[model samples]
Target: MWGREVHSHRVLITIRTKFMARDVHINSYLIVATCGGKAKREVSLEELRDHIHQYYIPLGRQFMVLFPEGGFLHKRREISQRFAEKNNLPKLEYVSLPRAGAMKVIMEEVGPHRDQAGTSKSDDRKDNNFNQNNVKILDTKSGDNIEWILDVTIAYPERVPLHLADVVCGFRPACTTHIHYRLYPSAEVPSDPEAMTTWLYDRFIEKDKMLEEFYRTGQFPPKGNTPLVTRPVRQDNVRYFILHLFFIASTFIQYKLWCAMWSCIW
Candidate 1:
C-alpha cells in the first residue's frame, strides 16, 4: 500500500515456509528467515543484514517492515513472556517481547553515523527540508543508511479469520483494521546492543498499552500521551481509479461475450 502511494518498491522479510520459498515469484523480493524449517535454527542478524544490503538496498525500497515479535500466536506470546521473565525483562500484555538483536544490527548496518557535532547528517538534511513545502521527506536511499524506522501496531476490532480460505470467501464484513505508527529517527536509536534491546522492549510495552486502550475504548490513545503517534494515512487514489476502470472494462467484455453466446444458442 505504501509502495503504491509513494511509487516506491518494497521488499518483505518473511518466514521461509516451504510454500513461500517454493514460489519463485514470491521468494524473489523476500529475505526469508529459516526459523520454521526442520533444522529449527534461526538466521543470524548479520546474515539478514547482508541479505538486505545485497538485494533490497540496491532496489531502492522505501519501506522494509520487520516484525520483531517473531510470531503472533498466543503460545508464542506465552513463550516470549517466560523468556522475558527469565531475562529480567518487562512482560508485555498485548504484544510479545521484541527480540532486539536484529533491530540493533539493522540500525548499525543501515543507520546514519554521527559527525563531530554528535548530530546525524541525515537528520540535518531532513530538518532543513521540513518547511520547504510542508512535505515531510526522509531520505532513505541517499546511501546505505535508513532515515526512519516506522514502528507500526495493527489490531483487528473483532475476531480475525486466520485461514486464507475464510478471508478469500468473504467470511467477514468490511472490518476496520486499526493501525498506529510511530516513526523513530535512526539517529536517535542506541548503538549499544543492550541499550538497544531495552529500547525495543520499551516500545513493545507501549504497544501493549495501546492495544489495551484500543480494545477497551475502540479508539487509539491520543497523540500527546501515547507513544503510538498517528500520521495522516495516504491513499493511492490513482491506483484505485485505474483498478476501477479495469474492472468496468473486464465486466463489459464479459457481458458482450455472454450475450453473443446466448444469441448463437437461441
Candidate 2:
C-alpha cells in the first residue's frame, strides 16, 4: 500500500495492489478533497491511455496494465522502452494500457532465486550458476512460476494487451549475483513521484484555469475532460437540518417568554 500526493492541488490518493489466483487486485481512494467532495465517477480508459502516452511513456519507465480478458498484465513498457532505445527517441516512458476501466500496478524486475519451494539461497551465486535471480530448476511445490511474482498496484483506467508481459520478463538477467530484492508497485521507485503527483493534481483541480491559460496561449485543446478532479462538498440536507433546529428553538423561547408575562399579569 502507498499514498501519493498529486501536484498542483491538495488531494492525497491511497493505492494498493494484491495478487489472488493469478489475478491482480487494485484499490484507490482520495485522502483529502477541495470543495463539493469527489463523486463516485467511472475512471475513463481512453483518457488514461492518453495520459500515459502523452506523459509517462516519454520518461523511460517500466509499467503494466491488465486487460479485459483477465489474463496476466502485459509487458508493454519493456517493449516500448526497447523500441525507443533502438531508435534513439530521446527518453521514453514505458507504460501499459488496458482496453477498458482503470488499473493499478507498477512492474518491477525482482532478483535472487529463493526457489518456489520456500528454499532460500543467499549463497547460490558461489554454489550454482544459471539464472538464480529468476527461479532455478523449478521446485514444483511452490505453485506455478507465476505465483512467485508480485507487483505494486497503482491507479489505472482499463484493459491492455498481454504482449507487455513478455517485455517485462526480458529485463531480469541484469541484477548482481545473489541479489534478493525485487521491484514492487511504488511511485517512489520510478521517475519523480512528486512530479507525477503534482501533474495529477493540476489535471483535476485546475481544469478551468488550465484551459483558459492554454486558450490564451493558443495551445491545442485537451482531448479529454480538462479537469478530472475530485473534492469533498458539504451536503444541503445538513444545512437544512441546522435551520430547522434554530426555528424550533426560537418557538420554544417565545412560548417561555409568554408564560412569564402571563404569570406577572396574573
Candidate 3:
C-alpha cells in the first residue's frame, strides 16, 4: 500500500474521464484523460513535459509515475494488440502496448546526456563524438539526469474489486496484495524510440511471467528465499494502544446513553 505519510513524495495519477466525476475535489495532481470516447481529449505530451520541467524538476522531485497502458481494460488490451500487430510490434500477454508518444518525448526531454565539461574529451575520440552528440541536450540547472526507473508490480491474489464502493463498504474480505519493486538504471533504457518501445514491453513481459507464477503458487519467487522486511512494530504500538482504549471508553458511554433513552421512552 502507498501511504502518503510514510513516503512524502507527491503523486500524480492518470484516471479515466468517467471516474473523474466521482472525486472531483481530489484532483490536485491527477491527469484526467478520456478513454474510448467520441469527444475524448488526450493529455498532450508537450504539456506534460513542460509541467515536469517547469514545476516538478525545479522542485527537485525524484519520481514520476506513468501508467503507459492507459487503463487496465480487456477491450483496450485487444485494441493495443491490433495496433502492435499492425506496427509489427511484439505481442504481449499480461500487458497492453504502451503509448510511446509521451514516453519518447519525455525521455528525449529529460534523459541523461553528457554535460559540457564531459563533452570536451569526446573530440579526442572520433567514434565517441558521434555517440555523445546523439544524446539529447537538457536545460537542467543541476545537470542531474533521470537515472532510475522503478518498475513496481502490484498483484491481488483474490479477485479485484469492481468499484471503489466495494472497497469503501468492505465488500471484499482481506486479501493478500503482493508488490515487487525493481530499479532499472538509465543505461538499461534505450534512448531510441523503437528500441525504447521494445524495452518497455519487455519489462511488462517479465511482470506477466511473475504474475503467472504468483497465481500458480500464491507466492512470489523470492518469498521463500528472501526474509520479510517490515517497519518496526514498536514504532506504532503506543499509538494503537491509546486508540484501543479510546474506542472502549466511547462504546461504554454510548451504551449508557442508549439505555437512558430507552428508559425515558418506556
Candidate 4:
C-alpha cells in the first residue's frame, strides 16, 4: 500500500535457519545460480519464470528486488574484477556486475502483454511470452503491471555491511545507513539481451561511483549530507513480538483443528 519511499528499518534473516515455512510464506523466492557458466544463466531464467507464474502472477506483486551482484559485494568483488579484466570491461570497485539474464526474465514476463501478443520482435529471439503469465497477473484484484524499476543504492558506514547474523545478533551497534533512490520506466529498460546487459552494467557502474562518493563524503551524489541518513534508529521489539505471537497463535489453531478432526475419526 505504501508507494512513496520512506525511511524504515529493515529485517535481515538468513535462509539457512529453520524458518523455511515462514520464508516461503513471504513473496521472497530464491534462484540458485552458478558463479560461472553458460548454462547457469538459462537455469536462473527458468527458475525466475516458474517463481513469477507461481507467486508473482497469483499475488500480483510488482516490485522486484534483484541483486545484480549475484552475491555480497565483498565476496564477489574479486571475481567480478577478474571477469571484467578478462573481458576488457570496466573494473568496478564498489559494486559487482549484475546479471542481465535475470532482468530479461522479469521484463519478458511483465512486459506489455497486449501489444507483444507472443509476436517475435526479432529473428534471434523466440516467443515474447506475453499471454498466460501477464493475463493471470492482470486478472488479480490487487494486480498491476510493473511500471518502475527502482535502482536503490545502500551504503554502509565505512564500507562495513552488516550480515544477517550481525543484524540479528546485534553484533554491530545501531549506525545510520545512507540510501539513494533512482527510478526508470519499464519501457526505458532494454528488452533485447545484448542491450539489456549493457544497460544493467551502466546502472551498476553508476552505483559503484555513488558508493565511492558515499565512502568519501558520507553521502551519495558527492553533495552535502541529507536527513535521509540522520533519522533516529527505531526499535523493532514490537514488530518481533507481534510476529512471534502470530506464529504461535496460528500453530495452536491448526493443532486444535487437527485434534477435532481426529476425534471424529477415532
**108-221: candidate 4 lDDT, tens digit per residue:** 665544246342223132223433333333431222445666676777777776677886667888887666776576667666668878888888888888777778887667
Q: Candidate 1, residues 143-215: lDDT per residue as tens digits?
A: 3355666676777755242346654555755555667766666766677667777877787778778778888
TM-score for model 1?
A: 0.61
- lDDT (C-alpha, whole model) for all candidates: 0.55, 0.30, 0.52, 0.58
TM-score of each: 0.61, 0.16, 0.59, 0.67
Cα deviation in Å at residue 81, candidate 4? Answer: 1.4
Query: Cα miss at 152, model 4 (Å)?
Result: 0.8
Worst 10-residue stretch by lDDT in candidate 4? 14-23
User: Number of clashing residue pairs in every model?
Assistant: 0, 34, 0, 1
What digit string (tens of lDDT, one per residue) describes model 2 on residues 95-153? 22211122221111111122312322223442354334453332213221112212222
Worst-scoring 10-residue span by lDDT in model 1: 16-25
* Preferred candidate (TM-score higher): 1 or 2: 1
User: Candidate 4, overall lDDT?
Assistant: 0.58
Give the lDDT ranking, best first: 4, 1, 3, 2
Ten contiguous residues minimizing lDDT sum, candidate 3: 17-26
lDDT of 3 by residue, 1-266 (tens): 11122224332222111112210121223232223332232345545545554555444455555655555545466787888799886565555665555455446555653232242212334234322545422333333455666676665644252457755555866554556666676556776667888887777667767667767887555545676443322236588679879998999999999999999999
Best by TM-score: 4
